[model samples]
Target chain A: MAEMNRFTRDHEWARRDGELVRVGISDYAQDALGDIVFVELPQPGRRVAAGEAVAEVESTKTVSSVMAPVAGEVVEVNAALASQPETINRDPFAAGWLFALRPVRVAELDDLLDETEYRKYVEELSR
Target chain B: MLRTPLFGAHEHLKARLTEFAGWEMPLSYSGVAAEHRAVRESSGVFDLCHMGRLVLEGTGVAPVLERLAPSRIATLRPGRARYTVILNGDGGIVDDVIVTRESDTRYHLCVNAVNRERVVDLLRKTADGGDTRVADLTLETAQIAVQGPDSAELVRPLLAGADFPAYMHTVRGEWEGQEIVVSRTGYTGELGVELFLPAAAAPSLWQRLVEEAVPCGLGARDTLRLEAGYPLYGHELTESVTPVAAGIGWVVDWSRSDLPARARLERDRKAPEQLLCGFSLSAPGVPRDGFPVFLDGRSVGVVTSGNMGISVGHGIGMTWLPAAHTDPGNAIEIEIRGRRIPAVVEQPPFYTRGTVRQSVD
Candidate 1:
């Protein structure tokens, strides 16, 4: 069950799971977006470039995009979120995982922030 | 930013504050969805001090207000209130207001915060040299709205045996020897009362009330009003939008030949090409202000106000469309993020089970 997690400046999170990387938004992103009502996930087998918007999250008042952290092909998508979008607000890390991707360049995860670095980044953002 | 008397209470509860109409107001407490549901099922409270309150006093006050507002002011009996609008020369809406006749010579006006100054200025100029005296009470008073099904039972004990006012009526009461005005009106379509009291005593009363009701914020207020199909000033109404086109032509007293914007209203009533209408999405998506609407491959209008109708469990919005396409069951499309969302034109109050006129007796 051990998985290494990394963060993006756009507030998305990537967890290293075997040869696949699981993606979801950070807790900060969900809190800032407020109660999510709907979510659209990228289709499995869809190829996307780094920083490309692959998902759309709709809250009560506004809509936000979830971007790909690195270039990859979507291997799995979270269909549960289509009916229970609030899961992202309730638990953004485990049960709320958005989609999984097979990374074309695994080295890109090294450039992302770790747990400690991401916490500090979010702290600085508020101040 | 200006702060309401309840600002300290909001800070104490750690509410997320946002700037609204020159005031620092609470956007949410626990969450938007939670607060919205609280008002629908139970009870919730709000600090509405950002709304403007004006007082006009004198025997001549009724005539001045009659000419300025679209509703019949001179015929309004004391203790009664009416929802009406102020208009410009072209019959365009200046602002939507609530006019309450407190007494023979005293009248109260509740207006939107954004148009407070303009409305006050307009009233002053219109009553110049007359016996009427105009006063702005917004900063000196605190307005608190307690709404929902249980609102009456929750607030009745605070007023010390004072009989509850009927809907759109007002009664004067006292809290700790300080005079407070209680009116049966609210933006949320619920059985509620709005209290007006001196600014200094508001925080204490608000603390007592919040203990029994959920402390709601502007986020829930917007959704509740939108679900009730009420129009917001800057959105559904503006200087360029007439009552006829805004689906509020009934407020105008057409029999009065000297009514403001008579010429323009008469013309629009005769032939209204475009009318404001309500729609609900057939698919999943949230329509928002300024998003273009389409009918049969042609762009017709744009959303005036839009939101997720939490109680109705769908996306509902308002838009101006051709009169032919504005009927209750007509089909239309709304473009969101480059996708056309299928929708149907439906009469609003999207959440129709409101207790707004339910008897509190």
Candidate 2:
């Protein structure tokens, strides 16, 4: 069975498939950022703590950081985004996934917000 | 927050709004990149009512303006416009403006929004003992700009009995019984016209033009102007920057004997310590304002304005560098987010396929 998705306050979303986790920015974050012009993804084999910046997203208006939602070691990065950053704007959930990580602490998954809580939190921010 | 006449129109289009110079204005409509491409490929209409407009009339207006600005206003013929700069006693630029000679004794001045009140106050103080009368018409007037290759085709049918004026020329015409001033002047380095009409007529005019052209916003405006190498008010120009160092010395009339900052400008004309130059990055990151520029690993300058040139497809910027380092082909680096990206100085107008000088006939 596929693990359910979780979110962080910084707008990053993570989905676990067995021991590996896929991370990307939420749709709300991409919509607020307008057109994504360039993105700098973290290198594979790098380790990051929760809430640490692992990538950057630049738009015509400004630049924003894509933080790690949980402590993990990066296993693979989305190499296609370096040439086509707009993918994140077009498809923030599936093809736009930034990287896959192997979590160091499996128990930390419970600390993230689920879909229901993330939806409520995002609604409050828009208001 | 201040709102222009077309504020409702922008809202109807679902534009992303942002605060600019105390006014709530559209930053983009559909998207910044798409709007920017529209202007380059075809035409785009912009609501520029947020800019300040002032009218000066009376027999001595020309002389009064000549005294307050560096341009030779007295020599400007009717229906012609001159781009000039207001200067302080120390040769620092107070503001850059476009003065249009409507008649022998009447002139129209377009200034930056942030500097409107200051310019009006200075003009009033200067006209105190003179025959000129200064009136601030910013609130009552609405300004619109139609720019790009297809601008003439888009605007020609809207007016009656007046041909599109030559570059830097102005003409008066009637549109639906309302009188308007049309000038063949723009900041986008494209063939374009600026329309100055009453505020009440702005919304309908904007609506009509939007039917034929893409509606652009401030986000695209900034990118377009940067690609054209135009100097923005607070960026490339400032209270401490003189026209000589800003690479716009031609606008200053050095032969005018009684100009306010003529002597100081002449003294600094030969060897300005720093000069404005254009550069493009070889790396991927975008160079932004306040980014440090380096030469041989030593910090030498700072970027004043920068963007990912939508047309050029690279990172482009303008910066103030020492006189010796302002030449084209000179290699430099811009420090962005603690990483030094390789760059090279180049001639301005990074996107050179502009149609601003193309003849309409």
Candidate 3:
């Protein structure tokens, strides 16, 4: 759990680091997707641009693309959820993180969303 | 988003809703795999209120119907339903329907939800018999497909001593004091019963079946039908495609010299270009509609319908291919996210072991 974090309306989270921000799918994404049966992770060393499709997680019924929030280098991944996909639907925030990053720019969090803003964004989607 | 009569019931049970044929339907309530397996091994019921039903009455019924439809309507006996395609004069399919001749003058027609209005309009204009009349009965009626290996066994307890035959058959029976039309037919290739009853009685009927033999949503219904080698309307069976090309040549009767479409269907025999084939992926990939299908590095066609086969417990799919490579055991590839994964063409009802037709002694 890091401070000054932001979430995209499309259900992606980013936490600011020194020069890079870590990225992963948000709690709402996993909840809507149900139990994640399979996940095709982005290559760890590759660079991804903002709004670009970087990964895929497939449930039994549908397969969804996880978009990159900010331009970044994928440095880490949650391999635990790769094998145990139920963790995503059960506990999406802590143990069920999708992937992390070595961001191209940390200030891009300004373009992302804070906790209150993200909550309102998710609220509008439900409507 | 259009809602079915059972929409409130689905919400109450906390079902996962998804858009289907312009109507909001439950994908699953508990789990797709669980519901699918339940229907395969035991029995499960589906709320089929979204499908369209129509009733036609008055004299000259068969004559009015014969002009529009490609099948011979005059040959149908009372209380018997015949599956036919209403063809465009040039010989393209409009939609597939089950027309039951209730009497010499009265008839009942069932059409898919998407093409219900289109089918009715086609019949209205083409039907020239002055004595015939048509009325849309979709809202007034509701049907439930209680299907599986144990479908007949479990539903027999509910019905009052009526037996049904194999595919494309129907029987009338009573359930809970209301006379019901119980048909031994279903889209899923299983020996199941489709119950046609009143609209108001649907919720209770669904409740009883769910309590008795596990309630199934559209998710299981889809997977079950796909595994059964049945062609869905928009996907495998389309207006642009003929029944012969869709792996359902058995439904088309070419012996009738009176029907002009017989000559049109024969033209396909001289030069058959597209052929439907069944596919299976051994590793881990589920092909979907619009996904590219390949054979020998050439893109032959696209996937029609696919899902995890509950009986076989593997990913199975159907796709159209060039007749040259449509043979069973021919190697093909499905382009899954740009990766050409190897697959093989297998004759469908991908699960070989199911009791669709009871053995006759």
Runs in model 1 deviating more than 4 A are none
Models sorted by lDDT, best on top: 1, 2, 3
Q: What is the C-alpha lDDT of each candidate?
A: 0.91, 0.89, 0.76
**Order of candidate numbers by DockQ, starting with the best:** 1, 2, 3
Candidate 2 residue lDDT tens string, A1-127: 7578899999989998778889999999988887777888888999999889999898888889998888999998999988888899899988999998899987787899999999999999989
TM-score of each prediction: 0.98, 0.96, 0.83
Q: State the lDDT of candidate 3 residue by residue for B139-209, as single tens digits.
A: 88788888788887777766586555456666777667888887766777776878888887778777777
Candidate 2, TM-score vs. the true structure?
Answer: 0.96
lDDT of 1 by residue, B12-117 (tens): 9999899999999999998899999999999999999999999999988988877777778988899898999988767788899999999989999999999999
Positional deviation of B254 in candidate 3, in angstroms?
2.3
The window of 10 residues in a row where model 1 chain B has the poorest summed lDDT is B154-163
| Better candidate number, 2 or 3, judged by DockQ | 2
Give Cα distance to truth, residue B263, candidate 2, Å.
3.1
List ranges where model 3 is wrong by over 4 Å.
Answer: A1-8, A13-27, A35-37, A44-52, A68-87, A90-120, B1-3, B18-24, B63-79, B101-105, B164-167, B307-315, B358-361
Fraction of native contacts in model 2?
A: 0.53
Per-residue CA lDDT of model 2 for B1-361, tens digit only, reads 8999999999999999999988999999988888999999999999899898999999889877887788799889999998998876687888899999998889999999889998999888888887989999999999999999999988887657678889999888666789899899998888999999999999999999999899999999999999998899999998888898898988877777786776677766877788899999988988889999998889987899987888888889999888888889899999988989999998889999998878886
DockQ of each: 0.74, 0.69, 0.26
When 1 and 3 are scored with DockQ, the better candidate is 1
Q: C-alpha displacement of A63 in model 2, angstroms?
A: 0.6
Worst 10 residues of 3 chain A by lDDT: A16-25
For model 1, state the Cα shift of residue A34 in Å.
0.9
